[model samples]
Target: MLLLGLFSHLLSSGKFWTTRRTNASQHIDIRFVFVIFFLLKWSHAQGSHPPRIVEHPIDTTVPRHEPATLNCKAEGSPTPTIQWFKDGVPLKILPGSHRITLPAGGLFFLKNDEPSASLKIFSADKDGLELEVKGAAPTVLRDEFRLEPQNTRIAQGDTALLECAAPRGIPEPAVSWKKGGQKLDLDSTKRIRIVDGGNLAIQDARQSDEGQYQCIAKNPVGVRESVLATLKVHVKPFIIRGPHDQTVLEGSSVTFPCRVGGDPMPDVLWLRTASGGNMPLDRVSVLEDRSLRLERVTIADEGEYSCEADNVVGAISAMGTLTVFAPPKFIQRPISKSIELGADTSFECRASGNPRPTLFWTIKNNRTIVFPGAPPLDRFQSINTEEGHSILTLTNFQRTDRDLVVVCNAMNEVATITARAQLTLDSQEDRPPPIIIAGPVNQTLPVKSLATLQCKAIGLPNPTISWYRDGIPVHPNAKVNITAAGDLIISDLDRKEDQGLYTCVASSRTGKSTWSGYLRIEVPTNPNIKFYRAPEQTKCPNAPGQPTILNASANALTIV
Candidate 1:
């Protein structure tokens, strides 16, 4: 089909030239005819067709300094020579030229300027065809900015948006953003991103995100930057160093340190939570360093306090407790008294302090005798009552105790104090010494059995009896019981722990007596036990067999 079309086109061209031919033109026409005959014979011999364009170059847009192509394909017997022309003039498309012709009659626009015009294509002895080729419009970007980002202010943890766009250009300008004169890497962080039309979006804005932002647009022709925009991030109040619980002495000064930070400097406030009011300005004041200072703090000022920091964004608070300690002071003193010999007398003492002082009694006449640690004297009893109150009683006073003095002491972590009272007797009475009538004797008991030791004493005044093992006091518990008659009883006695020397003590104000005895534990021995020696053998005749038990109990077992 291509061969027929080429032959027809050649005949038409010959006819056209003949109608307008002169003598010289006719001569050239005859040569043209011979060339056509030779082309037809070559086409038949090589089994080839005349040049025919299959695809033609179409209209297209190309950016400046960017590569592009205009395609044109043709077929022929001798591979027809393809030529390109613009505006009906042949185009000089050379090697290394910006506008160069392809091997198949296509035009290639290298990285350079492109022009829009009508393109013409022609093959050997073939009619020419025209197609429109166009370059990109607005190839050079304008100097003025198209869109600019404005100053943005947002709260922390909120999304921030900054919009930017480039001016019209042949090759659209690339848009980017920079912070504080440094290019922002959108791929390095997940919080910042470039969105629609090169707009910048920052999620979860933080304090570090506050800076000057600028948008940049660049193309082959030129580059432009938007006006610098400042980003302000509002942060809530945060406490860096808050108040802490502390203890201070009364009448002393103390300071509670507080430090806070925020975008809009937060205000600090000190409050007493116990009284549900602000700190009394009379003695307490807030220093320039944001610390609460209290001068000469008293017990009444000891309570829970709060340090509050507030800003436009939010508010926060911290609590601390102040503990004030005071030294011991006596509120009541014991009065001196005189009593008949052998008659009981009592003295009462009381004191007060910030920490509820401890009250105890001591005899100050001859030597210091601390109550609860005094020797066994039933006649002299010292009782501690409710809340800093104590009572000291002297019963059956003897002649040698006439000029004795009783002392009451109060103490706490802060300080200690003492008060003394003199006791005078009208007349002295003689008292008999303490004597042990019945005492514990040495005895042996079996394991897991019960045992009891007896101790009885007599004196002018009833004596107090106490039991001990190897000088260690024995207190009553579930397994050990001390009866009113001074008898020590032990149940479920252990073989190893319950064997020791026991002592009994009987004491009174005048004198004292003691009796000691040893306790032994008996353990039952196995009945079926015997001692034997086995002869040492150098070699064994047979291997030992597995043993089997015939009888078994908790204590012993038999195996064969």
Candidate 2:
């Protein structure tokens, strides 16, 4: 019985020790799980904050000689200590070489060390620098730029646009525009505007807008200009007067006007249509202010006219018509008076005006006739106005009709005028017969003798006395004497032939009268006859009253 009680006490003591060890192991495992959960939560919260930036806030673009700022910030427990590094080396604080100041209350300051702060630079290169903060470097720049409106065209009234851009720049560039060296002025009314991309814009375009345009972009480190872009504005010429056409009198005047508008003033010209001839032109006149003028217009002046305007940029033209006008007046005299008969006669009938008038002769017999000559008489004639004042001669005046009339007529010109006269016949009592007479009918006459002759006449207007001999009209010669008492006396007659017939004549308007006279001469017979007989003498014959011949030497014999 004593050995069984000692074995039961040893088993109970072993059970209590196993239970205490199990409880202690469970408490240690729970504590380890709680610590692991807190660590994971803290790591996730730190990742949510923005990364610390240490380079320039703006990127890639800067103008030369302009101010640039560098930034350095940190995000950590107790604000982790901040420092700067360049080219993989730590920077030391130096006196007078570095100016450090805190703008924002962060655990960092700006570095003003010009030489040390400068990043790697390339004149044409656009890439920016990488900055290191707290032994870690991050890329801090994003930049983009472009010019707007690749290509475009515009008419005079239409609108147009030009643009430039840089979406994001480290330091945004100032943008501007120029055309052929002149700056552009912008207006909202003109539809011109500028935007964020640094673009240049043009709203309305005209022919004057057709040229080169330049776009400029500038930043702190440098400035850039874009290649020239050309714009073209197209337009046609406009006519001021709608199809200006007209007609005018041939000897008058005409005018045509043309007007145009553009950036550059356009040229204007006038041209003709028929021969394509150009009209001479000058600057607008004060009187008419038109493009053309035609004075003293004529048929040859009729034609179409063209108005043309042009510039180095463009050109245009318009057309018009012109017409000319012509009209008719009298050319010769119509009145005449005073003419005669048995002689030539003529009259003039001339009518004066524009367009010559036709002339004809109208006789008193109511007959219309051309002039009497072979070819025909002209408008004028000459007549003798002597005896019959108003009489027109028909050549030899015969016992024809009494009152004759002569009229000159101009057809389609004027009224006619007539000239007339009365014809008279001669009387027989006004005519006279010729006369003759004779006297002094003896032949033989003594030296001193008287001769007488008688004269008579017959005529209408009385005849005068005159005598002629040997073809001479009885004028006194050297030794001849004449008396007005109607008798001839001869003082001493030397020859028997001195006695002959003499003639006396008288004449008058009606006829002629003539007379003749004669005279005789006598001589005494011989008183004594003496005869001488020579040695041998011949006998003479003796007839009827013959006397016998008696001869004596010294004495005379008488015969009875």
Candidate 3:
């Protein structure tokens, strides 16, 4: 087939020259054309030999980057058009790609290019492959030392791997590493090592690991130096001297010192992290000389201060506690409050000091806490500072509370202050009967479950609650418990026995009143049966040795 292509090309060229005559005098000589055509037919009759490969390509293991050549010469009547293939695929020939085939069928593989595995030779005329590509030889390509990862940054406690390679050397080069003019010890501990494939590795990089690194490749041919690479180990900021706690008197000067060290020099900031939010550093007195200073330190200036340092790599913070000694001083003391009977009122006071002063309300009789038996709603409640006020509430003022003097006590480690406020009340009307305030509403519940009938009443002179079941006094037992708030809890209730009208009677020295609610306990009943059907497999028995096949139709699974 290759010979036939060459024969056809020769015939075509001969016809073109004769048909387009350069001179009019030159005419087509029919005899010459006949002779040329005859010669071609005679040659075809003689039978030309198909292209046969004399030199074959073989497998080679060259250096990673080295020039290569694959010879594919053939012996035939006419020269063959050689096409190269790798891994069963035709190679696309490009002139500037450093990998190309010449007119004579010589193939070139430039440096830094990988020649394929399983080199195959084919005739462009599709005459089938005839080359014997016996696979062998390690052909390494040529390249000077080149190190990967020119520069890198990794945090401490991580591994660093840097590889340096020397390609195409006659003898494999010995690789050595250096950092900061000191020879790197590739020891047996494997911490700092030169591993397989000329890799320099370090385990758990530290501050000492930060340095410019170089890889040297040496052989009898020459010594090569790789481009300098840097191993930057990111280190978090650490306070070397600071986070010192100081306790100073008010109107004293104080300073917080902080020292930190890391690579790339980090930024520093002082912050006061509070539950409310971060207080901007500018809001407080500070000095930027690696320290924070407070000239006239007061309670407001006392807090846990932070020194934070950060860089592109990481960040860290150190806290220093500042304590300013200040005696308790009332910022605002509770004033005397006058209100009508049965009115709700609040008594408030606030003080500022370091070591935070505890504020409390003390009655004239030295009672700092309201009686435990007092209704939860009518008790003296402490207001949280989140509301911007420190207060104690006096709910439902009565005649007995009139003229009662109460003291607001604020104390800290330094000192204590007491401010008194006398309650002045107008003449009050007679105490009214208890009025039901919440719950004890009618309800239906499942049997064997727990239930609470909350009965809350509000009145003057404090009320005492009593419960009755079916008009009779009810006593608390294991399954029936009455809370201090007069709410009744029935546990493991019976369906029929626990269903009844329940009453709550509240009474005080002033008067008595009653309220009622009803409970219906429901026990669950079994679901009624509708219909049942035997499965088809049980109703229609299959013959022995025969399988019961299920229907595959869409309606086979319809539910009733």
Candidate 4:
């Protein structure tokens, strides 16, 4: 009871207390507490307090030749004594070392001459309770690079990251970047910045950003420059010059110019726009200059064409139109034929052209025959067949229609062509006198009015026909012509030369027939029709209608 009372009195007076020490020196304090516990043979009481730390030594860093300090402080009853240790060994101020213990339970180094060291603090009172604090040594740097940026590639308008790191140093190295030997200014642009332990990041990378890059680390110890790295910025594909519209003749060659620009060279292809089909490998080729070439183009090859360019970045296309033309060509031609009296005969002509073709017929004199107009004597007709074909038919063949010629003309924007054919009478054993079957009559027509006269004749053997106007041999022209059946037609009749006598003659080896007609042109007045003024005759007019035989044979005759 007396011993317990004495322990209580000591605890109440705060003479008995416990102290805490750093992990490194904790065992020293624990043994001291055990020795006190065994000597007193008593337990601690609530009236006294355990040694509690008010300040603890913390981790520290300093220059190689500079002084350093680690702060530590504690409080307890009966004032604790502070002690220092290193690596579980009691620390003491050696003769040559600058390390020493501080009065405030801290550690201090007058000069940091060693590479690295750690210090721990212990504080205890006479009762053997303890407390602790610990501190770390200064840090040092390394000599070699740990990581470096590497070559990289990225497309434009995308993010790019380049990693870099420097070796540890007394004063940490400063990381920077260089492009094409020029220093990168991170503060000047928001698109570029440093991150993730000295890694370079570029947002919305552009073509100008492509170049050799390097990572630089600088310190008092040394300077480090990473290996040169390449940064490639790719651009989307685009067309500079595209194909153009073209018009060419069939069987000719054509070319389409295609020029493109990109980071990497783009590939070009020619495609048919309508069908989206690939170009024909046999006739179409891509040139070294990136132009498209087509050899021996045809009508079927005409259409919308497109040239497409593509690369790893993107694709582009351009379009143009192609036109092909063909000249007129004859598919079927007129052929000469022989027909019997009163028999019908026809001539056919067919042609082909790119724009189709128009057809027309011409008579023996090469005078174009007006279409859809009734033949003077209802003995001739012209018919249009298919797109580019025509036919000329003769009805009720007569002797005067012998030795007739006809031609078929096909025309288009490209060219014009004609096919010619002749008609002859079949052989007949009996020969008879030529007689007139139809005769022309006199008529007075208005000026500029069309006039036509018919004169038909027949004989055992067909007869040759001829015409004369006002004592002169009638010449067929654009305004006048003689039909195969011995007829005459006058268009846009003028009073000056067309108002005169017209005569028709049919002749054969046996005999001859004749007919005459007068076309008097009159100008219509308000009240009465007046005859067109005629030139006065100096002397008697020659008999132009008189027939003169140019050539004669046993079965035929040609007259002028």
Candidate 5:
């Protein structure tokens, strides 16, 4: 009974043990299954996940006529899909879709859908249809900027305007004004005012304000400057006189009248040359009409004269000139007449003037004559000048050289004066004539003989004509021969003792002329004599009856 109870307790214990073990096993199995499920879920969560989309930018701001480009991008598991939208509406990718489709992802180009669109907005559409839109503000770009009244002139105590404007700009820029490299503040002054849009008004300009004014424009991105404008101011002074230029003859008195006009009568001071040549008050007199008078003008008076009018504001001046002139003058000797051939003549023409003078000579007739031709003879003869004097010399005067005139002219800067003289030739009768004469007055000759004689004459008239012997004119007589053109004659030869001196004379009304020569006569001798005899044994060379007698003296002789 005890053993049976033990066994039964063991069995019960065993059953309890078995039940706990089975429970533990079941818990372990459930844990094992849960671990495998967690692992699978973690693995699936770590694999290739889709990327998340973030910021998207699209440019919608562009000019009305300009094209625009939109940038679309996405962050996704495999780069999430991207698309474009217009005016908050999805853009369809199809033909005839007014909203044109572009390549997806990085860049998207689009035209301004509405040609007149202004202030439009563009957006990027994601695959989830998420919209990211932004608006672009229209900008104005400035092109040209300039200033009005670029240059101006204003009188003292007068107002002038300097205006500035811009043609086109992205933003309305601020305009500022500067004067002489310094900024001009906006204020209402007694003589200046700054107006809107960079306009400066000179309420009352003065000489001090005459300078350059510049306008500058300022903007967010850049700064632009314009040309500087010049401003001139004019003020009146006291005295005004002219010829403002004056010309006066040398050694003459001149008066320069200074007329004064101004608010207050200002004393006039004459200044020669701007530097140091100022005329003293005593040298210049102030007339009742406010005229500046100069007593006598000299060459020193020729220069710039400043007539200054002085007051509190400043001193204003006017300029004038005084000129002195010297007239031309001539100093020369007169031309004189002269006679005689191969003689030297002189004429003097000296001129003195402001400017030197020129001298020249001219002939009247067309006759061709030698140089220094027949001075005061045969018409007029022009003599050339060496410097300012004319010289003439006639070489050998003939009776034909008469009634000529020599002229000399002296010319100065202003005028020309001529002096002339006439030539009177000496009478021809006062000259002596040459003399001529002939010789062999007369001669006697023997019968049947030869005679030679000659006659020559000399005279100033070159005497001509017949020869004479014993006052009888001789010619070529046949019995009494003459030769050498009747100057010599020869009679028949008769005897040897007939030679004598003969006289010949020639005469002209101008003078006596004479000449002479000798005449010679010659006669021939008797004929030659000869003897001839007959041969008688070569004897009886002188036999009285057999001998021959010859006489050549006889005109006729006999020979035996």
Candidate 6:
């Protein structure tokens, strides 16, 4: 009962507690034991509250050689001791290392140091969160730093992408494009854009966009440039200067010049359609300047010529007209001929010229013949043939057609020529009387002087002439005789008897005709005799052994 009461008192005790020992000599204070147990359990609970970090040191990004900070916060009973570690090792504050440390028992920070460090926080009990410092430096690398699309060719209206290939760089480079040493207006030009702010893009490019392009990169690391890229905008061939209309003479050499222009140098070819077909280009030659040369061009070489230039984009051509000139020429000419009565006789004339010529025929006593109709004269026919061949035919030739002369005239815009021929008809009855072809004119002559008269006539069998004086037949005398050529000749004759009208008569199988004219004989006039007439002949002073000559006075001498 006493022990029970004691145990109950111990249980009921607030401040002190009692305990029993297994050995009597072993005496221990129950209050002391309870205090010792409470102390140990409190210690265990305090140790159980490890460093509970509510905020860990976060990663920070900073530029090189700049000030930055990393923060850390934690909680624990008995106040955890804060420390900093880098890369799993404790970090000690170094002298003059430009590092800042915060004063705190549960929160701390690092400042003014390189961000390259991987920081962490740890208490005396456990490790907290990991920390990171990101450091960046603006620098340009060597590789992948060139202008894209180097030496590229594109057509007009095509899109061009010109990029600065700077794949890896710090502080991202700003790309700018230039052409022909001039900056491009990326903001103003609607079709030109800076793609992703790193590449130059051109949409619907034209010939003006063809040039050397450069890409420039600028940043805090200074400026860097990429190699120049050639951008070519192809276009169809254009003929700036070429052969125009040309005029040249035949049998002469000629050259046609052409200039072709495009984005890329264009090739040129010459073609011509001339002289009934395409020109034999194999025989022709081309000069270094792309001029077509023809060695001795003829009239047949006149036609239209063309110069064509081609490239990958398209083709262009220009036309030139060639005019070759030649003088008029006769291929067939009119010829002289004689036809029997009621026979057909035709004359033909053919000519060639640069321009086709007009043909016409004209007769001596007939009307001219032209195109669109036959000969106007009866029994005459006009025929037109190919290649300027003209024919004039005379049918049933009559006496009127004898000794007829005809002419073939060919004329063009440049030249004119004519061919003439005579036509004769074989007819007898309808022929006129004997006609005199040639004769001598009648004139006065001195008495006792040699005189001759000629008469020429033409007939079928020829004609003879009869000489007459004063309308009387004259007999042949010693000084007067008739020649075989129907010529009357008198060596010496008396003026009174020989001076009279003269006539020539001609006869033919058809008829006879005579022509007369007065042929007066001239007489010599004597000088008048003086009143004191001297002797007819007088002798003057004579030389030795020489006969004396007498000077006859014309005024004093008279014929007996």
Q: Provide TM-scores for the models.
A: 0.43, 0.30, 0.37, 0.44, 0.29, 0.46
1-560 in candidate 2: lDDT tens per residue?
22123224434344221001111111110000000000112222333432234333322222222334444444433233444443323445565543342443121223221221223211111221122222111111123345444455566766656666643332456777777877777653345566545565555656677787777666554555666777777654455553378867656777776767544566676666685573433321313344576677766666787777776556778888876544211122322322232433434444322122234445654453544232432322323222212212244433342233455443332233333322232223333433442222344444444333334443333446665432345554443434453333344544443555556666654456556555444442323422221111124232356443221111232233
Choose the strongest candidate by TM-score: 6
lDDT-based ranking, best first? 1, 4, 3, 6, 5, 2
Question: Per-residue lDDT tens digits of candidate 1, residues 262-294?
Answer: 889899988897666756679988889899999
TM-score of 5: 0.29
Off by over 4 Å in 6: 1-150, 155-185, 194-200, 203-229, 233-237, 260-267, 274-290, 310-315, 428-560
After superposition, the stretches of candidate 1 with alpha carbons farther than 4 Å from their true spots are: 1-191, 195-208, 211-230, 234-242, 260-262, 312-319, 366-378, 427-560
**lDDT tens digits, residues 1-560, model 5?**
33234335544553220011111110011000000000111122344443333544422334433444444444544344564433333445566543443454433334343421122222112222222333332223243565544888665676778777743443566777778889876653556655676677887677788889887776553466778899877664544553277776556665656666543445566667833786744556766765566766545556777667764434667777776655434455444333455444444445443334444443323233324324564433445454544454444554444445544455554466655544434332432332332244444444465455544443334445355544555565565554443355555544442354444455444444456554534323323322111223225243254423221111222235
Tens-place lDDT digits, model 3, residues 28-96:
111101100111122333566655667665443334356666555666554555555444455687757
lDDT of 4 by residue, 1-560 (tens): 43355445555664333333322210011111211111122236555444456776555534455677766676554345566555445557777688776787666778765444433333334445433333322333454568877888777888889888876654578889999999999888999999987889999999888898888887654566888889888876788999999988789999989998887888887789554564666898889988888999877788888888887767889998988778878899998776777899989888887777788787865365835334633467887854556778888988777777888888878789888887777543334456676666788778787887877776646687888887688888999888888778889988898988888888876677888988888776535765533222235364467554433333566566
Q: Give residue 545's error in model 2 in angstroms.
A: 80
Q: Evaluate model 6: give its TM-score.
A: 0.46
**On a 0 to 100 scale, what is the lDDT of residue 499 in model 3?**
79
Model 3 CA lDDT for position 8: 58
Off by over 4 Å in 3: 1-141, 145-158, 168-190, 204-213, 216-224, 230-236, 244-254, 263-266, 275-289, 295-304, 311-314, 321-409, 420-560
Error of 2 at 380 (Å): 35
Per-model lDDT: 0.71, 0.43, 0.63, 0.69, 0.47, 0.62
Clashes per candidate (backbone, < 3 Å): 3, 36, 16, 13, 42, 0
Query: In model 1, what is the error at residue 301, expressed in angstroms?
Result: 1.1
For model 4, the superposed segments whose C-alpha errors exceed 4 Å read 1-56, 59-205, 211-231, 271-286, 295-305, 340-344, 364-366, 369-388, 392-403, 424-560
Tens digit of per-residue lDDT, candidate 6, span 483-550: 77666677785678776777777886657767665656655553442222111112423224432222
The regions of model 2 sitting more than 4 angstroms off are: 1-83, 92-155, 163-237, 247-249, 257-268, 273-287, 310-315, 323-560
Clashes of 3: 16
| Model 6: lDDT to the true structure | 0.62
